[model samples]
Each structure stands twice: as structure tokens, then as C-alpha cells.
Target chain A: MPAPIEFYFDFSSPYGYLAAQEVEGVGRRQGREVVWKPFLLGAVFKTTGSAPLLDIPMKGDYAKRDMDRSARRIGVPFQLPTPFPFSAVAPARAFYWLADQNTMAAKDLAMALFHAAFGQGHDISAPDAVAKTAAMHGHDPAAVRAAHDDPAVKQRLKDEVQAAQDKGVFGSPFLLVDGEPFWGHDRLGDAEAWAKTGGW
Target chain B: MPAPIEFYFDFSSPYGYLAAQEVEGVGRRQGREVVWKPFLLGAVFKTTGSAPLLDIPMKGDYAKRDMDRSARRIGVPFQLPTPFPFSAVAPARAFYWLADQNTMAAKDLAMALFHAAFGQGHDISAPDAVAKTAAMHGHDPAAVRAAHDDPAVKQRLKDEVQAAQDKGVFGSPFLLVDGEPFWGHDRLGDAEAWAKTGGW
Candidate 1:
């Protein structure tokens, strides 16, 4: 079988939330399976020496406008979550914990977390919030909450983030086809084309 | 007449070079004239606290690859100029000088400079090099060279950069359709759509 498309994202990223809604369809069209990997953008930012998009001067204002415009263009319900860019550790750890059991359920839990954070403007930074979202997806709430602090789960997230940095991922909504990297939500079309044609 | 699309770019930016090749076609399709405003990204970067793409760490390496890949994907011949991120002052000044006389000729000259700098990978930082390129378009080489050092020409570029910052332009290939702002080369299509449909 051909290699799967690695879909890397951060739970706090608005563009990542937007791309998640469509990446499955992109993979489906090309008969490829998408492996969802939620990593910490904050850690990547430290290596890149970059700040959050909304922290820049003029670019920040434009980004705020673009996020809303991009969401509307894609027909996704979006509102900048209050306490913008909350820590994504809770959701990310939960994703890896469940992913160890069932990849499909992990994806469902990821979408649930993304929807609650961006789609409904809920904060998924807290362990309880993340656990509640996972519980809705048939996960045990107590187990899910405990997973956030589990040593193995935390190590998994740290290793995944390091691997992402090693692979040169510097932004949210990054995708990889085979070993080729495509960054940003806008590049999803290009990524799909690359997968379909095996690079142009 | 409807407001024309404002196309802003920097000569040193690879993505700006790529977008310069296609922005005019987008404007033509929507029955709108494109106004090319070449400005100093270096000056704008100061306010935004951003650096050149290839100067950043891991992102720099990925950008080098993406520049080549994006160029090939769009069928445009591209090479990161020998001295990547060269000063754009000379060519920008020459542009404003010519634009003051004939907007059409100025547009042609802008493309010619872009082609020489990015398409052919020539160093365009010096006034003499800019003059040589301008001469190919029937401009007097000495007059074009002198224009680069003229105080009024220098002020025009400075004012343009200031105006761009005021309008929240923090990156190359930034487009304004009516009043809606779109950044990056990938957004050219979205800008065209907005112009055609008066926005979605």
C-alpha cells in the first residue's frame, strides 16, 4: 500500500480547524488514508522564532479578517474562540491516547475537539473540557481525563512534536504526501494534486 | 468605474515574483484594471517584526524548497536570485519615476524588472543594473539611472511603503479588491472572485 497522507495540526489554530473539515475528503478522492497528528504549534514557534499570527502588528489585524473570511468562504461555522489560542495540550494528549486504541475513534475525537473549540467557540484547553468532548465520542470520561497527565501520553505528544520539527513543520494545517511537505490550509489543493499526480 | 485592484509586491520576494506573473490575468478576467504598487518589504518587516522567509530557521529551508516547487506548479521559471533578498530600492524608484509619466509603460517596465531579477536571476540592486533593464523598454539609460537617485523618486517609494503599512499590507503579493484585502500569491483567485461577485 502507498504511504498515508500525514495531516499535522494544532487544536488552537483557526486555519487548522478549517483544513480539518476538508482533509478527509481530499484523502478520500485520491484513495489515500489521512493519519491525523495533532502537535503543539507553540513549541514549533519557539524553534521558528515566530509569534502567534494575531500578535504581529499590521499582519495580525489582517489575519483576524482573513480567518473570518476564509471560514465563510469554506462554509464552515467559525468564531475566534474567547481566550484566543488557549493551550492545546489537553486535546492533543487525549488524541494520542485514544489514537493508540482506535485510529478512527481518535479522528472522531479530534474533530469533536476542533468543532467545540472553533465551531462553537468553546475552550478545549482544560482537561475536563477535552474529556467531555471525548466522552461524547464514546470514550470513558475518567480515563480520558487521566490520559492528559499520563506519562506515556505526554511523551507521545512530545515525541510527535519533535518529529514534526525534525520534518520541518513550522505551521499549523501542514500536510505531507509521501515525504513532500505542504504548509497552510490554502495549500490543501496543491497537496491533493501532488498526491494524485505524484508531484508536478 | 469600480475600484481597481491594488497589487502590492516586493522585488526580493520569491512568492511576489510568482504572483507578479499572474495578477494581471486575474484583474483582466474580472474586468478590473490592476494597479501595481512595488514597495519596500524590508521597511514593512520592521513594523511587523518579521524577517525574510529564507532567513528564518527551519522555515528558511522549507521556503527555499517551496519557492521552487510553487514556481514549477504554476509553470513559471524561477530561481532564488544569487543574492537572495536583495535591496528593491533602485527598481522601485525607477518604477515610480516611469509611472509618473505613463502608467502603461511603467507596468511594462515593472514586469521587465521582475523578469530580469527573478526569471533570469540577475542582481537588480544597483542603479546601473536597473537602468540597463529600463533601457530595453526604450527608456534612456542615463535618465533612468539618474531617476533612481532623485530625491522626489526616493520620497515616492517611502510614501508608498508608509501608505501600504497604513492599509495593513505586511507581506508581498498583497491585493485589495474594492476594499477587501488578500495576502499571498495563492489568494489571487480569491481576490478575483471577490472583484467579480462583489464578495461572497
Candidate 2:
């Protein structure tokens, strides 16, 4: 009805995983639509000159602990994915491909993929893994797999990431409320307040 | 009493300014002593291979917006100071100097400096500014000025920053609650909960 809250996240970001589990509720509470827009942090990082939070020196170790503790604090399941900071091309492309046909199903598949990667600490970096996760949401595995390699699906994902970078979406769990960009899972509350109060 | 909650911050950090306003209240609410430790972010950044949050590319523009928005969302005054990311040596050294004489006075003065920097959007890089802030907190201006360059006071601040790095603190508004390191003002709520529940 009003402006939809555009949630931008990367598949490999633990903070994005944590926010994915909660942003919908926040949107529902504020009477706004939550649009899940997954983009490649790898591409965004190239523009920002930053790396994965876990790739830094001492901060890398602290991030591991924070991810676990933050998940627990928020009452969500989280296990750090292995070979993390994975590329979002597979899952993101699959999401857009499915979203073209079914937006609801696309969201469901996104939950499944996030859950697989962060909930159980499994690797969803492969197209097969993303397709498998999609199947659980009633999508055909074969179609899902095909979307990953389809040129249009690939471009859709590319265009989305390009749009995000052009708009300065530099980190995971970023939200855009009426074109106001809120970065990091940390700002979820602030985003919620912005949605609720109309402005601050 | 158990261990006091350790607050590590750099004087020039916007998030640190926000946290400085609330950490004491959180500590009081949780029935713990809140220890204020000001360190040089420049030194910590050198060790962590990180630069100021605003120095990065796309993220830099977003950070400026986030700082102001977050400060309002949380109901605190904030404005980006001129020539932002100022050196913390003068303010931090003055803090440590006053701390050596009076811990309470040091905290009061710390608040004054933070208010001067963020609340009024003033430059606090000069020794005179810090001395003036301390004087407002009931300390003598001349004494505060002399402490900024005192060999012992300078070394004290340096040693504190070194110790913080050894303990893996790499950001401002970082709180170590019962040895659990929480980075960012965004994690302040998590830190408070950790202090209250003995950690989740």
C-alpha cells in the first residue's frame, strides 16, 4: 500500500542471515511490504574497497563469536557457513528466475537457502544446492538449476547487484526505506523506527 | 561486585560518542561499574589494517547518513564534526591524565569532550579544546592543558591503546563484558543484555 521496505542482503553474510529471519516481522509490524533483494557482496566490496568482515585481522575472530552470540540474542538459528563469503550468483539468480514466475515461492526458496547456509552451516555455493533448497519450496529442481545458467537470469542478478552498487548498497542486510539506505543488520531497529514513525 | 563493563572508544568516533552517552546508564541498570577507556583509533587502525569508516568509498557516504540517522533514532544529539575523524590523542591523553587523578572527573570530562565534538559539531583536536572541556567538568584548564603533553600521560594513553589491541579491540564503542567483546554501537543492546543475564 505504502512504500515497500527494500531489504538488500548477500547470501554469505551471517548478519544478512540473521536479518532475513527478522525483517519480515518488522515490515509486517510497520504495515510495509518487505522486498528481499539479494545481491553479491563481492561486487559491492569491489566498489567499497572492503573485504568480508571475517577476513580482517583481529576483527575476523571477533566477528565469528559476534555472529553466534547475536543469533542467539535474537532467538534465531545460526551456524557460520564454511568457505563462507560465498558468491551470491547462484542463489540470487535462482531467486530472480523464480521470482519472475512466483514472488512468494521465490521468498520461500530464499528462506530455505539462507537456512541451509546459515541455519545448518551447510554450503549453498553450488547451483545444485540452491536448486535443492528451492525444491523444498515446491519449485522443480531442474528448472531451478537451469535458471542458474540462463543468460537472462545471470544478467538479472548482475543488473540487481549493479543497481545496488550504483545506489551505494555497500554491505549486507542493507535496507532502503523510501530511498533512504540503512546498512548493516545493526540498523534494523532504526529502519523499523523509520517505517513506524514515518520519519525521525 | 563482579567485573566492571569495559568500554573502549576513540574520541573521534561518532558511534563512540553515541555509546558514551548511554553506556553509563546501561551499566547502572545492570548493577555494574562502567569503566571508560579512551584509546587512539589511529593506533588501533594501524594494527588492524583498517581505516576510518568514512574513508571507504560508497560506504563512506552511507556512513555519514547512518551516523546522523542513528543518533536521532536513539534520541541523542549528533552532527558530523568538521575535518571529521580527528585525532584522539589530545582528548584521550587528557582523559587518561584526569583519570589518574579522578576517575569520576575523567568520565565527566569525557562526556564534555564528546558533547563538544558531536553535539555541537566542534573540532576538539587541539589541546586547548580538551582543556576547556575538562575545565567545564570542574578540572583546572591549565592542568588539563599540561597533561595533554605530559610524558607520563602520553605514555599512559599509548599503553592503553596497545593493551586494547592485544585484547583484540579494533573499533570504537567496543564493549568487553565479562571478556566478551562486542564491537559497534549497534551491539550496545547485546552488550547490555550480556551484562544483565551474565551472557546468553
A1-200, model 1: which lDDT tens digit per residue? 67899999999999999999999999999999999999999888888899999999988899888989989999988888889979999999999999999999999999999999889999899999998988887889999988888999999999999998888888999999999999999889889999999997
Extract clashing residue pairs from model 2: none
Tens digits of per-residue lDDT for model 2 on B36-113?
Answer: 998877876776778788889987888888888878877888898897878878999988887888899889889889
CA deviation > 4 Å runs, candidate 2: none
Model 1 spans with C-alpha error above 4 angstroms: none
- The positional error of residue B27 in candidate 2, measured at the CA in angstroms, is 1.2
Per-prediction TM-score, please?
0.98, 0.96
Cα lDDT tens digits, model 1, B1-200, are 88899999998888888998898898888888999999989878889899888889988988888889988988988886778779999999999999999999999998898889888999998899999998988999999998988999989999999998888888998999988999998888889889998987
- Per-model TM-score of chain A alone? 0.98, 0.97
CAPRI verdict on model 2?
Answer: high
